[model samples]
Structures are given as structure tokens and as C-alpha cells.
Target: MLGIFVLAPILIGTIAYIIRDTWAKPLLFLFQFSYVAFAFSQFLSVKANGPIIWNTGGYTDGLALSLFADSLSIFMVLMTSFIYLAFLIFAVNADYFHSKFYFMFLVLEGLIMGLFLSSDLFNIFVFSEVSTVVVSILIMLNKEKQAIYDGMIYFFVNVIGSSFLLFGAGMIYRTFGLLDIRAVSAAMPMLEEPQAMILPYAMMIVTVSNKTAVMPLFSWLPKAHGTPSAPPVISAVLSGLYIKSGVYLFIRFNQMFAPVIDMQSFFFWVGFFTSVMGVIMALGQRDIKLFLAYSTVSQVGLIVVGLSMGSNVAYWGAVYHIFNHALFKSTLFLTSGLIEKEYKTRNIHEIRGLFRRMPWVGAATAFAVLGITGAPFFNGSISKYMIANGTKDAGITLLLNIINLGTILSYVKYSAMLFGKSREEQPGKPERIAAATAFVLGVISLFTGLFGEFLTEFFFGIELQVDTAEYIKKSLVYVFMLVAGVAFYKGLLKRDRILERIGTTELTFNGIITVMTGYFITILVFLSSVL
Candidate 1:
């Protein structure tokens, strides 16, 4: 299954490369639609009782090439295909459309499919590296000096993360003498020593954090995400599906190491800190793109907290939010891209009264902002309710309720920049491709939220109650958050304070400190067990 899906895009690109003249564009479009059709078929076939496993090639004792399609994998597959379709449309209409660009895009599409479907640990490492390298090529396509700098930072941070991933995979293989994820998970209890499990678990956390841009490891993400030249879809995929690859591994391994590790406390604290830090940084941003980039970091922290709860509801929350965040966040970024292209500036202060100029884009941005902030009749509300319920059940102390408030506060800042009250009109035209994608996804978000229960059950194979009264209660909390955010912004406006002024030098210092801290902490634990 994985090989077929992964190979499809590569095959198209290779064929396109060969033809290069008459048929390349047609072929690219054909392959894009074909993959989406195939993905939807796979989704329909998957049952919640168990996953569908396909092992086309034999495995060496220490390496396996296999694929599995479960509810989770199906959702990711669908997302990759849908997002790729939008990117393809953008490519067709882009001012500069090169064959090389299409090739890179197709290769990334295939690699992501492989990453999501692979059932082997070593295979995850292989495909993840492929995705990273190919996406780096897209970043360089920005044709700006800052793009290269951002790409370099992206390369440096990801290499550090990849090292951790490989080390952890090696540790697991060394301990169990197997490379397949299902086998390692099943055999985890057979290992007699607790330290063997703890070592790999901690390494896995570092690796996952590096990819997902969790606090302390997220220095590269803002730079990479804010790079001016990359397309909005690329930014969306980078922040959305690609980052979740690490989170997927964490979820898989968390189940295996549940007995040896206390993931709840670790995720809660890291998530709390990241959430606060991300929003604070976003509030101080002059560039709206950077604001959205940091917002991705903060929202990812919320997803992590939900995943760490380790309950069925929390699991549902994490998974569902992954979908919600992808659609809403992408809509926001694409809308921002359109705004920047029209006004010829990324500064929010310079672009005031945009709502009157581009009413359609403004409306789209409003929908996305409300959706991500967990407003009622939106997808965010559904998943957030589940997380709140699970948090109470998990007894996670400190900031459970506070985190919910922060979600609303952060979006309040977002709204001010995106849809401020001043309605000044400017004469201009909108980018057709960008606006189309934004509007389509915005409508999809509203549909998802209105039928939120149906979508949840369809994906997870479990039906949950729709608590109307509790939902109303949650709305009140959001109202409070909005009020607080307005107050904070008013204060900042009056005082002219710096909110996101972590100098590049400061970020570099923090990155160094974080990487070293991760290394020494792992070693200390390993030595403690040995001594």
C-alpha cells in the first residue's frame, strides 16, 4: 500500500521529466487526481476493528519494508492528497511554472505518503529524510537570499533531530533485535531492564520535538515557515502533515513505553510552556506571516498536551485537531499570502483597512480565525471539548483551564491583524489561485464543524455524545479569553512594548543550550541505570 502510493507520484514525476514538452502538465494533473481517488478508496476500505497490513517485500532481520492502512493512516493519506491537489492548482496558475518545481512537488507528495504509511521504524527514518531534503529544495526555489538562509537553518535543526531519531531507532533495534514497529511494540515487555526502554523513549521525545517544533527545539520552524519565497501550500504542508510525522512516532512509542515513562507530566509542562511562548512571540510580530508561523508552534503544543493524556477521548482530540488545524491554518496562511501579494507588504500596520478592499479574503480569514479559536459551529470546538474532558479525567494539574483561555487570547491577536475594525478601502486585484483555495477550505471547515459529530465517528469508528450544554459553557470561556486578549493588545499598543524580540543571536544561543541539554540528559539517565 505504501509503496504503491509513494511510487505513484515519483513515477509521474519521472515520466514528466522524460516527456518534458507536450504531456508533462497533463500527466502531472492526471496523477494528482488519480492519487486523490486512490486515497479516498483506501479510506473507505479501512475498518476500525483493525488495520490493513501489506508487506510487499521481505524484511532483513534488522530492516523491514511494509505498510499499514488504519483509521489514522487513512486520514493522513487523505490530507496529503487534498493539500497536494491545491498545490497543483496553484502550480498550474503560478506566474513561474517550471518542470523542476513540479518534480520536487511530486516527489514530496510521494515521500509524505510513504512516511505516513510505513509500518517499519527504519523505513520511517528513510522516508522522513527524503521528505525533508525535497522540501528544502522547494524552500530554495524562493529565489531570495533570506530563503537560502532559512533553508540552511532548517537543514541544521532537522539534522540534529534526525540524528536523535536514528539513534533511538538503533537503540530499539539493539534492544529487541527487530526493526518492525508492530514487532518492537509487541516485544517491549520481554526486555528485562527498564533503562533500555527509557533511553529510547527519551531519545524519541527529542527527535519528535525537533520535527514538530515544540518549544526549545522550534528555532528553525519560524525562520523556515516565514521564508518569503515559498508558496502558501508548502508552508501549510510543512507545518501541518510533515511535522505530525514526529508526533505520530511519539504516539506509537508512547503506548509501548507507557509502563516505564511518565509522559503525562513531561508533555503537559512542555506544552504549557510552548503554548505561552509561541503566542507571546506571535503577538509581537510585525510580519503577519511570522505571526501565523508562531501560531502553528503554539497550536502544536496544544495537540501534544491532548495526545499525552493517553485516554481514548484525548487520542480522538489529538487526531481530530490534526485535521482541523491543517485546514484552518492553511486557509489562514494562503489568505495572508494573497494579502501580502496584493498590498506588496507583510507588515500588518501598513496594511490597515483590508476588510473593505478585499471583502472575500477578509471573510475567509475571519472564518478560519474563528474556527481555529474553537468557536461554536466549527471543528475546533468539537476537538477542544474532548481535550477538556480528557484533561479533567487525567488530573493534569496546573494550566489545564488556563491553556484553553490562552487559545482564545492568541487568536484574538490574530483577529486584530487580520480583520481590524477600521474599514479603509484600497484599489487592487486579488490573486485568483490563492483566493480560490482559501475560500474552498474555509467552507470545508464550516461544514466539518457543523457536522462535527458525523465526521468524528466516520474517522474514528466510535460515536461520542454531543453535549450541547457543555458546548455553551465552553463558549463562555472563549468569550473571556477574547476579552483578556483585547486588554493585553490595548496595553501593548499604549506602552509600545516588544513582544517577539528574541534576537537571532539569542535564538542561536537557545538552540545550542537546548541541543546540549537533550544530549546530557539522555546520557545521565543511561549512566544512572548502568552504574
Candidate 2:
């Protein structure tokens, strides 16, 4: 059953690719629906029984290929299935839909699912490399203008990251003579020299950081996610779900190496700065997609902060945020795509009267903005509050608030498009499926906020008793931040030349790789010093 979750998609995708007929797409869609149903069943099974483990060739030793599905892995699989299903629906009505596109898309989906489920280190490396190739190809699929250059940069940089992962895996294999994660965990505490694992841990984590788009290594994210030529659905998936794979691995590896390394504080500070820089960069973006792209960097940073806090409450909050971010961010990106189509431009300044012309898209966009900015009744506010509750450090709490303020400011700039008069009425009716998808996601975003505690308990089996009075107090703080964000945007960001320059500046491929190298070296040195 566990193997079916990973292999079925690949098998169907390969068949679709070979067929290359119009019917192939419909067949692929059926397979996607089947997979979602299968994932839901797996989730229930995991809840009722224990974790599911399957070893190929009936070999139980570390050398055999294995798939393990626990609550976390199954939950992630379910989330990916939902998002991919939405993407598939959107693609059905999109100009980019074709047999070839569906084939690659399905292949990528299988690889991602496998990455989440694999129990062996080597299997993870293999899945990551294949997924990297598929994503680069998808990124360059349209081949418009700099698409080739963008794809090459994404490919080369991630290949370098993959090399680091391979080296780290080798180190682990040499140290323990085993490759299974469970086996490594069992062997870790009995090792004579715990400090010997630091180098491998650091190497692997830095590579994961690049995938998660933390700090300097993040240069590739905006380029990949906000590429003008790529399909908007691709951007939505990449920002909303794909990068979470890196985060998931970050958590997994930290658990595996816990006996030898304690780097929670290191990631916490890095995430803090990444959040700060992400929002600052977002403030300068004129393109709506690019603005959302940088905002994702900021959100991922916040998620990292939550996960690194070493508190179970914060860990769950981080997990919930990953889910919430996927919902709201996907809504934003899908709606942005609709707006771009209707307005004939991606510039925030040039686009206006969204409400007057395309009310559905405007309303969906507004809901997403409110959710992301952590408005009192929105989903983001709940997760943000939970994450805040996990920390006792004043400085860390203050930094969280600052990040929240920056978030509000960026979205305030974004919401301007919802107002003002339209230059012309949009021609033709909007795509019904796209509009329906966005609206449904928007509604879920609101409902998740309204019933956050219940949903959290339902999904994660953690009871969260809400303190209404305390929440009301936090709501007041949110209002203050909203007002401050408005003032800051109007008074400073509106006329700031330096910020404009910073936002508009683009880095070349070489410059990006240089930053990644510096990031790797800095993490290595910091870990060496601390250890």
C-alpha cells in the first residue's frame, strides 16, 4: 500500500508520456484523483494502526529499499495531493495543458511523494536529484525569453546542493555502515564519538537551507518562482508546497542527528534574519508575482523559526503554518494570474480596479491578503499566535512582531490594486474552473482561521484550548501593526529611491552561486565554533 502511493503515479505518468494523445490528460487526471483517495486512506490507516513500513525484496536490513509512512509523512502526502489536485484542475483550463506537461507534472508529483515517504538516505538523494531535474524542465517548459537562463541557474545551483547531500549521505554510511534513517537513529546514541557527525550534519543542513530558500541561498527562489515566462500554476505549486519538502527534511535530519548536534539556536537566528530580509525585499517589488515570491521567502523563514524553537507547540504551529501558507499563498498566486490576464500587466502600479472589474478575483485576493497579514480572524493569525506562544525569549518575540509588521506592510501595498477605477472592462467571461478553485481556497483560508483550534486538533491530534481574552488582546496588537504598516508604506516606501533600487536589482547566476557558497561556509564555521 505504501509503495502504491509512490509508484502508481510514476507508472501512470510514464504511460501518459508514451501515449502522448489528447486522452492522456484525462487519464492522468483520473490517476491524480485516485492517488488522492489512496493518500486519504493511508492517512486513516496510519491513524488507526501504527506507521506503515514496507521493505522491497523482503529484506529488513538497512541495505534494502524502504518506504515508511507515519502521521507526518502521510499528512504531508495528503496536503501535496490536495494542492496538486487543484493545480491539475487549473491546468485543465490553462493554455499550457498538454500530454507532455501532464506527464512531467505527474512525474514530479511522484518524486515529491516518494521523497516524503522514503526511509533510506540514498532513496532520498535519488528522489531529490530526479525532482530537481523535473522541476528545472518544468521551469523552462515555455522557453520564453530568459527561461533557459533561469532554468540553467536553478539546475546548476541545486545540483551543487545535491552534491553536498550525496557527500553527507556518504559520511553517514561510512560512520554507521547503514543508510536507513531509523537504523541511523538507533545507532546514533551508541556511537563512541558523537562530535564526528557535525560535519555531515552541517553539510546536509546547508543544502536543505538552499532548498528552503533561507537567506543568501534564496536568490534562486524568486527567480524560479516569479519567472515571467513560467506558468502561474507552477509558481503557485513551487511557492506553496514544493519548498516545504526542504523544511520537512530539515526536521527529519535534525531528529536523526540529535544525539551529536544541537543547532536549534543557529537556525532560529538565521530564520529571523531571513524573515527580516525577505519582507524588506518584498517591500521594494513592483511586480505582483515577484512581490508574492519574496513574501514566501519571509513566510518560510517564520516557519523555520517555529520549527527551530524546540517546543512541541511551536513545532505543531510551524506544521500548521506550512498548511495554511499553502492554502492562502496558492489563492494569491492563482488570483494574481487571473488579474494579470485581465489587466494585461503584472505591475502593481499599472493594475487597478480589480474589485470594479473582476469582483470574484478581487474578493479572493483580499481574503488571501488578510490571511497572510495575520488579520485577527484569519488562519495566519492563529498559527502566528501559536508560534509566538512557544517562545519565552523577549527578543525572539519582538522579532516575530517585527516580521508580522513587515508582512502587513507588504500586503498593504498589494491591496491597493483592489481599489480605484478601471481603465477598461475585461473582455470575455473568466475561466469558471480557475475562479471556482480560487474562491474555494479563499473560503477555506477564512474557515481555517475561524476554527483553527478544532482543525489543529483534528489534523495533528493536539488539543489547543483557546484563550479568548488573550486572543482579543493579540487582536488589538494586530490592529496596531496594521495601522503602522499603512503609515510606513505611505510615508516611506512610497517615495523611497534606495528601496526601489534594491527591489529592482537582479542578481546574475554567478552572483547567486557566490552567495550560496558564502552561506555554506558561514554555517560550517558557526557550527564548528558552537560545537
Candidate 3:
């Protein structure tokens, strides 16, 4: 069953391509729905039973190619399968919803599922490399000049990053003579010196960090996700879901190294700095896609912080945040596409009167904004509240607030487009399928938040009791931050010369590579010093 989850999509996608778009349409609709059902059933099975492990080629557990579905990974598989269905629904009426596009899209889904489920290290590398190729193709699917350039940068940079994973996986294999992650993790404790693992850890993390879009290694994210020519669904998937794969792997790798290595403190601080940098960059973006892209960087940073906080509650909080981020961020990106079409522009300032011109789009976008800003009774608030409860340190709590404030401030600029007199008339109700899909996602964002406590338990099997008084207190803080955000945006941030200049600042490809190299070395040095 676990192997089928990974392979069926790839097979079906190929069949869809061979049969062409005319037949492919219904085929995909049926397959995608079934895929979601299958994934959900698997999720229930994993919840009822413990972990499920399948070793392919009929080999032994640690010796054969393996697929391991634990509570964590099963949830990821379910999320990807379900969300891809939403993306498919969003794309059904789109111009690019042809045979070729669906082929790549479903193929990408299969590879991502592979990444989530595979227990073999080499298989993970293969999946990562293939997915990078698939994503580059999607980025340049239109073949526009700028799209081509962006895709080329994405392809080459990610390939280089993937190389680090290959090296790391090889080292692990060489060390333990086992390719399965579970096997190596069990073997790690037997090593006399953990120092031998440092080089491998550094190599693999550089790749994961790059994929997660952390500081110094995040320049490529905007180029790929914020590309002007890519389809909105592409951007949504890349930002909302694909990025979380890295976070998933980071958790896995950390667990694998838990016996011999622990560097949560260092990464916690790195995540903090990355969050701040992402905020500064996001605040400067004029393009909605770029702004959302940068905000993803910030949110991912915050998730990393939660993960690295060395608390069980915070780890689960970060995990929950991944799901919430996937919901709200995907909605934002999908709605942005509608906003762009209606306004005939992507400029944040040029677009106006979202609520007035297109109520559904505007409302949906607003819901997402509320969630992303951690407004009370939203999914983001629930996840963030969990993260906050993970620590008792006043300074850490204050820093988390600072990050949330930055989020609010950037979205203040985003929300400006939601209201004001419209310069152009709205289209025939914002393309019903697109509008409806995004609106539902936005609704889900709110719905999840309203029942976040129950949903987290249902999904993660962890009952994290929330403190009502503290949550009420936090809600008050959110209200204050929202007001402050608006005041700051009105008082000083609008059309500021410094901010405009900052928005325009971008690193070249060479510069990104250099930063990545430096990041890799820093991880190596930091781990060496700490361990």
C-alpha cells in the first residue's frame, strides 16, 4: 500500500500523457479523487496501527529499498495527495490544463510522495533530483524568455544543491553499509565518535536548507516561485507544499542524528535571523508573488525555529504550522492570480478595491491574510500558540512577537489592495472554478483554526492542551500588533525610498551560489565547534 501510493501516480500520469488531454481530463479527475481517498485511508490505518514499513524488491527490512509511513510522514502524504486534488481542480479550466502540463504536474506529485515516504537515502536523492527537474520545467512551462532564465537558474542551482545530498547519502552508506534511513538511525548510536557524522550532516543540511529557503541560501526561491510567467498554481504548489518537503526531511535527519548530535540551539538562532531577513525582504516587494514568496521564507523560518526549540510541543507546533502554511499560502497565491487577471497587473500598489470589485477573491485573500498574520481563531494562531507555549523564556516569546509583528506589517501592505475605489471593472465573477477553489481553501484555513485543537489531535495523534487564558492574552497581543502594523505602514512605510531600493535589491546567480557555499561551510564550522 505504501509503495502503491508512490508509484500509482507516476504510472497514471504517464498513462494520462499517452492518452492525451481529451481523455486525460476525466482520467485525472477520477484518479486524483481516488488518490486522496486512498491516502486518507492510509492515514487512518497509520493512526490505528503504528508505523507501516514496506521494503521493495522483497528484501529484508534494512537491506531492501524501503518505504516507511509513520505518523509524521503519513500526514505529509495525505496533505500532498489532497492538496494536489485542489490544485487539479483549480487548473481544470485553466489554459494550461492540457495533457503535457498534467503529465508533469502528476509526475511531480508522485516524486514528492516518494520523497515523503521513502526510507532509503539514495531513493530520496533520486526523488529530489527528479523533482527539481520537474519543477524547473513547470517554472518554464510557458517558454517565455524570463521564465526560461528563471527555470535555468532554478535547474542548475537545485542540481548543485542536490549534489550535496548525493554526497551525504553516499557517506552514510559508506559508513553503515546500509541505505535505509531507519537502519542508519539505529546504527548511529553504535558509533564511538559522533564527529564522523559531521561532514555528512553538513552536506545534507545544506541541500535541505536551500530547499527550505533559509537565509543566505534562499535567493533562488524568489526567482523560481515569483517568476512572472509561471502559472499561479505552480507558484502555489511550490510555495505552499513543495517547500515543506525540506522541513520534513530536516526533522527526519535530525531524528536520525539524535543519539550522536544535537544542534537545536544553533539552528534555533539561525531560524530567528532568517525570519527577520525574510520579513525585511518581504516588506520591500512590490509584486504580489514576490511579496508572498518572501513571506513564505519568513514563515518557513518561523517553522524552523519552532522545530529547533527542543520542546515536544514546539516540534508538533511547527508540524502543524506546516499544514496551516500550506493552506493559507496556497490560497493567497491562487487568489493573487485572480487578482492579477482582474486588475491586469501584479503591482501591489496598482491593484485596488479587491473587496469592491471582486468580493469573493478579496474575502478569500483576507481570510488567508488573517491566518498568516496569526489573527485569533485562525489556523496560524493555533499553530503559533502551540509554538509559544513550547517555551517559557520571556526573550524567546518577545522574539516570536517580533516575527509576528513583521508578518502583520507586511500584510498591512497586502491588505491595502483589498479595499479602495477600483480603477477597472471586475470580470465575470473571478472565474468560478478558480474563485471557488481559492475561497474554499480560505474557508478551510478558518475552519481548521476554529477546530485546530481537535484537528491537530486527529492528524498528529498528539493532544496538546491549550491554555485558554494565555490564548486570550495572545489574541490581545495580535490585535495590538495589527494596529501597530497599520500605523507603521501609514506613518512611514508607504512609498519610502529606502524600502523601494531594498525591494529592488536582488542577488545574481553567482552570488546565490557563493552564499550557499558559505552557508554550507558555516554549518560545518558551527557543528564542529558545538559538538
Candidate 4:
């Protein structure tokens, strides 16, 4: 089941390449939908926590490709399957892209599935690198020079990271004489591990951090996602579902090294700073896609904190939030794309009277905004509350509070752009394409709200007990935060002083100061603890 689920996209992609026509699109869509069905079937039949691994060549123990289906992998597979479906459907309305769009996208989809399912260390690295490359190729579908530039940067960064990962794998193999994840875990305790052996770990961290767009390493993300030719929903998936995979690997690797290092303080503060940094960047963007792209960086910081906090509840909450982010963010980006299709703009400043002409898109944007901002009765609200509760238990209340403040401020900026009065009134009929897309997304968002608890239980292997009282309390907190953030945005963002700081391009000296200061502070604290 796991191998089929992972390999289906590759097979489909190959077929699509051999037979490119109108039929190819529907075929790709079918394969995506089939994967979704396979996931649900597996969920019904498989045990909650047990892993099923399929190894080729008659199940040889030493050297064969293996795919593992666990709850975590299944959850990601299911999420991507649905998202790809939406991406393809939404893409149908666009102009002719390269034939390789279908091929590369499906192959990338397969690679992600394989990455999620792989139980082998080297294989995980292999599949991850492949997926990264495929994504770069997909970006080239736009044929923009910026796409090529960003793609090259992405390629270099991932290659460097992969080298570190390979070195790390080599070190682990030398120490334990094993390459499989399960075997390595079982053998890790007895290995003669040097503290400096973590250089590979550090490199791998840098690699995944860049991929996931953590604050300092995230300069490429806005450029890549803000590209005009890429589908907005695809951008959303890049931000929402795909980035979480790196975080997932980080968490998985962290567990292996738990005995040697404690990352609680480090991750808490890293997440805190990254969260604040991301939302601040988000606030200054005039383009809607760029704003959402920065918002993803911020939300990712929160997910990282949740994973690093390491409480069972926190871990599961983070995973739940991954699912929610994928759905709502993609929906929001798709809505933005639909608006751009109709109005031919993503500039928030020029995107006035959208509610008058494209009310459904506006409304869908409203729901998605509400969802990501953690409003009550939506999927984002539940996971965020869970994350907050989990963080409190993990002694990260202060960091979480700062993130909350930043998130509220970011969303307030977004909403103000939408609801603000238009400078010019233009009356026009609603676009069916925009309306249809928005309606679908709005329904999905509402569905997510109603069955939020069910999703958590199904995806995370935890029972969600609905607490009406807690929900009410959290609702009030959200309301208050929203109000406070709006006030701050109006008072501070409207001011020339703060706006100048936000809009100004920092120079080489400033960039160096930031990186050195942040990196030094991080290492100093770690060294202090060790000494």
C-alpha cells in the first residue's frame, strides 16, 4: 500500500509524458484522487501506531528499497493528495504550461510521498533531494528569469544540505554499521558518539531550515513564491504542506540525538525569533502573495516550536496544524490567484472594490484569513489553542505569547487591506471562475471547522474532547488579540517612522550584523550550557 501510494505519481507522470494530450490532465487527476482513497482505506484497516514497511527483493534485511506507512506519513500523504487535486483543478483554468508541468508535478508528488514513507536514512535524503529538484523544475514552467535564479539558489542550497546529510549518514554508519532508520535507532545507544559528530547535524539543520524558510535563511522563499507565473495554490502547498516535511525530518532526527543534546531552550527561542521576524516581514508586503508567503514563514516558526517542544500533545498539535495550514493556506492562495485572474493584479493597494465585484473571492479570503488567524469555529483556531496549551505545558508561554502578538498583528494588516474602503468605485459583474473557486474553498474551510476534532483524532492518533468552555475562552482571547493588533497596525503602520523601517532595504553591514548577532547569540547560549 505504501509503495503503491508513493509510486503511483511517478507511474502517472511517466504515462503522462508518453501520452500528452487532453486525456493527460484527467488521468493525473484520477491518480491523485486514487491516492486519497488508498489513504482512507489504509486508515480504516491499519493499526493506529503500527508501521507497515514494504521492502523489495523478497524482503531482504540488509539492502533493498523500503517504504513505511505510519500514521504520520499517512497523514501527510492524504493532505498532499487532496491538495494536488485542487491544484490540478485550479490549474486547468490557466493557459498552456509546459507538458512537463503535469509530469514534474506528479513526479514531485510521488517523491514527497516516498520521502514521507521511507524508513531508510539514505533513501529519505535521496527522495528529499529529488523532490527539491522537481519543485525547481516546476517553477521553470513560468519561464521567468527570476524563476531560474531562485531555482538555482534552491538547487545549490539543497545540494549543500544534502552533502551534509550524506556526511551525517556516513558518520552514523561508521558508528553503528547500520543504514536503516529503525536499525540506527536501536543501535544509537551503544555507538561511540563524539559531540563534534554533530557538525553534520548542524549542516543538516541549516539545509532543512533553508528549505523550510526559517527567518534568516528565508530570503529566497518570498522571491520564489511571489513569482507571477506559478499557481497561487501551488505556492500555498509549498508553504503549507511541503515545508512541514523538513520540520518533520528535523523532529525525527532530533529524537535520535536526544541523549546527547537538549534543544528545548534553543528551539523555543529560535522559533520565537523566527515567528516574530516572519510576521514583521509579512506586514510590510504590498503584494498579497508576498504577504502570504511571509506569513507562511511565520506560521512555520510556530510549527517548529510545537515540534521542538516535544510534548506528545505539542507534537500532535503541531502535526494537526500542518494539516490545517495546508488546507487554509492553499485555499487562500487559490482565492488570491482567482482574484488575479479576474482583476489582473495581486497588489493589495490596487485591489480595492474586490468585495463589490468578486464577493465570493473576498468572502473566501475572509474565511481563509480567519482560519489562519485562529478565529473560533475554524480549523486554525483549534490547533493554535492546542499549540498554546501545549506550549504552556512545555514552559514556553512567553515565547508563544510573543508569537501570538505577532500573528495577530500580521493578520490585522491583511484584513485591513481587504475591508478598507476603495479609492475608486467600479461596478462589475462577478467572475464565475473566481466565485466557483471561492465557494469550494469556503465550504472546505467550514467543513474543517465542523469536523476539526475528527481530523485531529484521525490524523494524530489522539482523541479530541470538545471543550465548549475552552473554545469560548479561546474565542475571547482571539477577539481581544485581533482588536489589539488592528489598533497597533493603525497606530504604528500608518506612521512614517515604522513604515520606513519596514520598507527600507537593509545594506550589507546590516545583514551581516543581523546574521552574526543571531548566530553568535545562539552558539554562545549552547556553549554556555555545555561548559
Q: Which candidate is the best by TM-score?
A: 3
Q: RMSD per prediction, one decimal?
A: 2.8, 1.5, 1.0, 3.1
TM-score-best of 2 and 3:
3
TM per candidate? 0.92, 0.97, 0.99, 0.91
Error of 4 at 132 (Å): 2.2
What lDDT score goes with residue 420 in model 4?
A: 48
Candidate-wise lDDT, in order: 0.75, 0.87, 0.91, 0.72
The candidate, 1 or 3, that scores higher on lDDT is 3
Candidate 2 C-alpha error for residue 414, in Å: 0.9
lDDT of 1 by residue, 308-413 (tens): 7767887798788888888888888878878887777887767665567777787788888888888888888888877777855444634656665666666665
Model 3, span 37-132: residue lDDT tens: 999999999999999998778899999999999999999999998889999999899988887898899889999999999998899999999999
Order of the predicted models by lDDT, top scorer first: 3, 2, 1, 4
Task: Decide which is better by lDDT, 1 or 4.
Answer: 1
Cα lDDT of candidate 2 equals 0.87
lDDT of 1 at 308: 75
Candidate 3 versus the native: TM-score?
A: 0.99
Model 4: pairs clashing at backbone N, Cα or C within 3 Å: none
lDDT of 1 at 450: 90
Model 2 agreement with the true structure over 1-531: per-residue lDDT tens digits:
788877888889889888887878788779889888988988989888978888999997566888988888989999999889988887687989876787788888889899899989989999999999999999899987678778888899899988888999999999989999988988999988777887788778877988999987788888888988888888898899889899899889988998778889988988888998898888889999899999999999999999999999899999999999999999998998888888889999888888888888888898999899889888998999899999888988898998898899989899999998779865335688898888888888899999999988877888987689989998999999989888988998878878768887767878877887787788778777876
Error of 1 at 1 (Å): 3.4
